[model samples]
Target: MTSTAASRPGAEHNGFTGRYLLLLVALIWPAQLLSVTGLLAGNAQSQIAVHFHTTQIAWFVLVSSLIGAFLTPFVMRAADLFGKRRVMIVLTVLGVIGDLVSALAPNFAVLLLGRGVAGFYAPIAALVFAIARDVFPPRLVGPASGLIGGGVGLVALFGPFLSGWLLDGHGWRSAMWFLAAASAASLVLLMTVVPESPVRQERTPMDWAGGLLLGGGVSAIVYGVGRGSDWGWSSAGFLASVIGGAVAIIAFVVVEGRVAHPLYELSMLSRRRVWSVFLATALLAGTVLSAGTISQLLGLMPKIPAVSDGLGFSATKLAWIGAPASVVIILTAVATGWLARRVDSRYLLATAALFAAVGYGLTAHFHHTVPQLMTVGIVSAIGLGMIVALVPVMVIEVVSPAEQARANGLQNMLQGTLLTVVTQLFFVMMARDGRVVQGTQFYLDAGFTNAFRLAAGFAVAGLLAVALVPKLKRLEEAETGEAAR
Candidate 1:
């Protein structure tokens, strides 16, 4: 006979139940929407540049991506120490406040500050993954996590179109206003529906030194890479930032090894399989970020006056091209989760990398028409969807439940750092040798092609790393046994 609901060991906890997994997935949408607000406003580059310097456009994108990355480890640690639900609510509220700040900002600096504040929302996905592992049944974990992965793509399907509509109707600020309202609504639902995690790590003092060193190191390195083309690769500032950042990172590693209750366990890095996954994930992260950025730039770039360099599509037209790819991402992510139950995850991951490589290759060489671009996008989305759905499950399989949040956080940190570096490289490549047309404010066709090629190279690297992933049947069986007990 089936056991009664009350008989379930952890069912009585007031936390988000299995029935509410969809709500948890829904809560993540606002953050995803808010994160891409800058991308949605790509058509307004000239208008924004009129108010702020052209360089600030890059800063606007960089700040949001970097700040959230630097804060993810801390936020994940907080979620582990405090409660995931509590921390999520706080972050969501902050996201709302950030949207409002951006919406009402009188100047570019204040808007950047607002975007930086919104960066806190970046780790919400890790928190949700942790919650799914804690709250859902073992059988449901993959599907639940898949939904979280897919939800991002699902929202992307609509976000651009909606933002474009709003931008065309009102103004650039209208998108921010929409983000604020959406974030507020999501915040309310999160508070009312999601329950606090029952599990909490014992409180430990915050690792201020580690945080500072790591943040400074990452920031310095990213800055160097980002500005290397503009300032000259051999410039004194570039040398100082890169070299200093490297030293700081080494020191940070040494510190992590020595600290009790460290931000991340050094021993985890020693495992070949684990490290391989991390490396592969980092490459995949770079691929996704670079590809997405290139796609947006290509979509918004005006056609060359004498040459067929760009499609010169409106934001709405670009959204329609992107929307189908988003749907494919969602579907593929969900399918990957279903497949993981039967197939080895490493193969799935490797396939993901392969898809990315092919997609980027196609875009680099043959993207002249809208249909070609859309085809490439769909191909890349498949790979991205698989990576998103599988990586969390793979991490969970390898680590104990207690360490899941930190593991995911560390994964995010690595991915974010790599993405920052890769994005800088993309900017450098695109901006090389007067790639931007004077006064037209659009990139040369070669810029987009070179960036896409770079993305393909990263995907190839990811494939190599994924190939090193040890077969996890033994590990999976062991975890399954432990869960059965």
Candidate 2:
């Protein structure tokens, strides 16, 4: 579901100005899926890694990142070549099926496969932005992107708490089942509400060699980092995965540069603004994502059983723990959208990053008590909401109208990939004995201050990333000015 741009004459002149809002409703679910990755990360520390006999939590991060990196750009290009609606529907269906497979998996291998398969569908982060770019005027794009992101943040607020509760009570599998339902519903919504893009482009052939090479490269890097602690960094398996992954990426670069219609347009990478948005998006996602992971970890190993286990509440009840955060995100998202319309998006982005850093820095210190935790969560949610909402809007600002869909998709893919990779690295370093271990004692003894400090550092980096964006804008404006003269 997406807003088609008012490209055709009289489309905006008629009663169609607000029509994109209708498509945006359908777009919400895919963006909702982004929360699933966070949920999985938090829950995996409790449920999956040990069951799979993995010593390191990095594997989960690695697999998710590899899959996302491989699939996102490919899906984006596909959307451009075919049609967004067509590709979106296919992704939805595949995601639904992937969820079912993940929920019903009998073994770690199957579970991993199912989770990885879900990544292939690529979430709606990019797609929603593309839709906004398609449907709205250039001026309205920034606000529209924020509006859609706000909707997505609403989902994020609830998804993790629900996932945490389900993991605590029934098991992680139940969480997967929940996602499957959402995916199916999204599919149905798309079918009913999404309209085909009136401005379709000629189809390009699937770049099989490029896709495989890129996928293999990412998988190898993810695998190496994920299993490094368990397999030994110097071991053949680790070395091969890392070095081989790098080679694969190099191969992809060469192939893409040679191709007439590359899977990823190399020229796009040369654009300074695009890179700025990419780096900022990755950092912002990683920072806010830490919130969900911390929440799940806290639930898994509370100071007492009653608190950790939700006081014997049902999974449904526990899910509501995240509802407040979700509600705030929705409100803030709308607020941000309104604000974006008034101010430059760069300012909005920087403010969000600063607030997020402060919120995470504060939240990390108050993890000893649940009420304190809730307060932190609320503050962080507001900050996180502000940051995440800008992802697609940045894309719309940097890319041309025709390139919006693919560029947005690739943006999400890269961000998700980076987040996954970083999550794996963090887990590997943070976990005890390279296993899905909880750090309750560490938090109690050393205090939660350390984690908060680390999170704040990440947030600071994100702020810097946001600052870089404005520089790109200034550069573009200067180039335009010189051209005008």
Candidate 3:
């Protein structure tokens, strides 16, 4: 729609028909499709690994997610400064172009770069939420946000099966083609049907200084971590990257403190309640991401007792068998949403942490059969679902209304940051522990052993962080954070 036909401040009062409602639903499908499953290449990991002739398969997820984690705040802030429609359209174009780059790449470098570009999908959901608030009435905004936020349930339910068909039947490139095609369709609908949001916030200059510091710091650190297995851990190159990145982060915090419109509001970190959310988010979110990758890796093992005993399934069978857990997770998320309203969120977090700990810890020792692994997955899925649902709840209950958006943005930033660390950490362990057999890299039984043990440890640490969380002051009347609003 053109600006002349665009929505205005009071246009939300203008009632919509089923036509507009369908448009909103259309907008949500791609947002969920790309943002949640974009970097999740586990379904195609074995093929991509063998095709690229490298076990640094972690980079497939790490680099894309690192790019997303480091840059999402700036992108979301850009949406707020410029316009949502223009920014969302730009991100969609970037995704399509990125997919094309990834699909046709001749080497890993080009594909990695393409995946990084595709990270633009991460901030699209936040923009979707803002657009809904601008376009819908108050009565409908809640349902719209709920639909967009938790709608991942339905996606999760079918995502594995769909990936199994596409990746197994056509090849890994088919998956990229699917995302690109879906994103392209979403882009056309978004441009033709979704009008620009007229709602405005306090207009401020973009915080390029803070963005550069944070981005540069994160790039250096992740570069160091991702390469640590290749570069000796104590090597000067690794030391320089880690030390330099830490210094840059310190500089970012100082710069943010002085800047009028900080990219990441540093003062919020001073609050105990808020920092606890961040700390827990960092640890628990990492474990959550690691779980999917761990399961995929487990599925590919050869199932030799005492040497390597795992499901020994192809990616297709892995996806089909894992479908049961996805169903449980979706159901648990629904139940969690209901429970969050009635229970103390910290109790939820602590309970989730324990469940995750037990599930991962037990799987470290006993992963023999499909039934055994399925039980472990179902147990962990419950905890993972609760943590996924409650992290936002904890953010709202802990942060004051004034700083809620920044808190949420920073929370997302922290989640991505820790996820990168955990993924790199696991791969590093695998590299260190695995063996080369007949020119093929094999992750030994010991590697999976240590990785699951480490995951359990991280969950326990998250539980400690949960203990420190206290109910924060809230303006129940004020708007909650944008992810759910």
- RMSD of every candidate to native, in Å, equals 4.2, 5.4, 4.0
Clashing pairs in 2: 4-134, 4-135, 5-134, 5-135, 55-434
Relative to the unseen true structure, what is the Cα RMSD of model 3? 4.0
Candidate 3 has its poorest 10 consecutive residues by lDDT at 1-10
lDDT string for model 3 (1-485, tens) is: 11223433443443445765775676677667653463247666767776787756778877777777677778767766667778889988988888788888788889888888888766675566556655665445434544454556566667776877886688888887887788788888888877766544466899998888887787788889888877889999999998998999899999988988887667678878788878885689668766667667778655554444445786667766767777876777667666666676678778989988988898787766777777787777777777766665566566543444455567766777777788788766655667654334557667877888888888898899888887644323335323222
The lDDT per prediction is 0.72, 0.64, 0.70
lDDT of 2: 0.64
Instruction: Write one digit per residue (lDDT tens) for candidate 2, span 1-485.
Output: 22334343323332325455665667666765666655655565545654665444444445555676767666776777777778888877877887888889898778778877776665556775666556543444555567667765655656656655667667767777887887888888888876665444556688878877877787678667777767887999899989999999999999988877677776887888888888887788766765455455544533443223212333344456667777777887778776654567788788878888887788656665546656767777787787767666566567666666767766675566566655554454344322123422211312234545567778889888877775434212221101111
The model with the greater TM-score, 1 or 2, is: 1
Q: What lDDT is obtained when candidate 3 is compared to the true structure?
A: 0.70
Write down the lDDT that model 1 would get: 0.72
Name every residue pair that clashes in candidate 1. none
Error of 3 at 387 (Å): 1.7
Better of 1 and 2 by lDDT: 1
Error of 1 at 45 (Å): 4.5
